[model samples]
Target: MGMTTDPFSLLGLEPTAALDPAVVRQVFQERAAAVHPDHGADAADRAERTALFASLNEAQRCLSSTPQRLRVLLQVRYPELAASHAGAVMDGAFMELFGAVGAALEKAKAVQSRRAGVVSALARAMLMADETMAADAVMGALGAVNDAMGALERALPALDETMRSGEACGPQLKAAAARAGFLEKWQAQLRAAHAGAVG
Candidate 1:
């Protein structure tokens, strides 16, 4: 509606980290339909519509996740603070867990890759036990990652509360963002490992 970079404004949403997914979806659908190129008047209008559509998609993506939404808000509301916050580090324990999960994923991948090259049934059978073990290890890693994510999610409300109250400085948000990134990456690796084991 307005030529602004504020994602919430672009998405026709109230500027808050706590967003309802349903509302975001509904608004995006309505706006996207309204700006569909088929409904544009001319080439110029179509170009503008295309840009708006892209912006709307980006806005929806940014608002759909807690950490991403927080990051966007920080960039918009406190650019200087956010710049400094970039150097913030995640907890040492979280980093340790992430490292362990990554190592497990690599081990699983190595087993899966080795199994892929085995042509003979006997050779494949010989590797089945190792494959099974690797899969089990991946599951164990996934469980640990999930546990860590659960703890982080549980603490998110407190962080949100502090941010809302202006009590949380930049580092707090930065740390949460960093942890979220690590958790997201770990979960993705776990998914890939699980899929490899399954298929």
Candidate 2:
């Protein structure tokens, strides 16, 4: 409850900031199928299974976007991030990181539209950048992720609007999930890099 230390790991996934909906859904189905109450009719581990199921779901929702995922991570590591949202602005370093993440997300989206495997590539870029990026650069990348996350957050409405307009929602949702995976990977890399260097 107190930030759920290592929330990503709670679901048996790696410590990452963003998550691939496909993978998340896949894993959830696999795990949930095994642990769901219906499957646990004769088990004493029902409570634990339920907890795991819930954790998996929480992980999916929190890691669904860069911003939401970042917020959860920051809540665990930098509690102050939540505080600064009221009137005060994020630190300059954070602002820069947010911008970089947003731009990367846009690129990732384009790559997704073309059916390119952009998640690994985008993640590789972030991972490679991690080796030498300054704190400011790291924060900038995070900021960009936040921007991408903003785009993701707006998707629910977009999906609704698209449906109301008679456009297909399938392609757009797929693309958004793809880009979201990239953002998630980038955030994980950022956290990993930061922890490696400074933690």
lDDT of 1: 0.76
Candidate 2 C-alpha error for residue 162, in Å: 1.7
lDDT of 2 by residue, 91-144 (tens): 475456556755544544333333333357776465443333444455566666
RMSD of 1: 2.9
| lDDT agreement with native, every candidate | 0.76, 0.55
Question: What C-alpha lDDT does candidate 2 achieve relative to the native structure?
Answer: 0.55
Can you list the residue pairs that collide in candidate 1? none
Clashes of 1: 0
* Model 2 error, position 79 (Å): 40
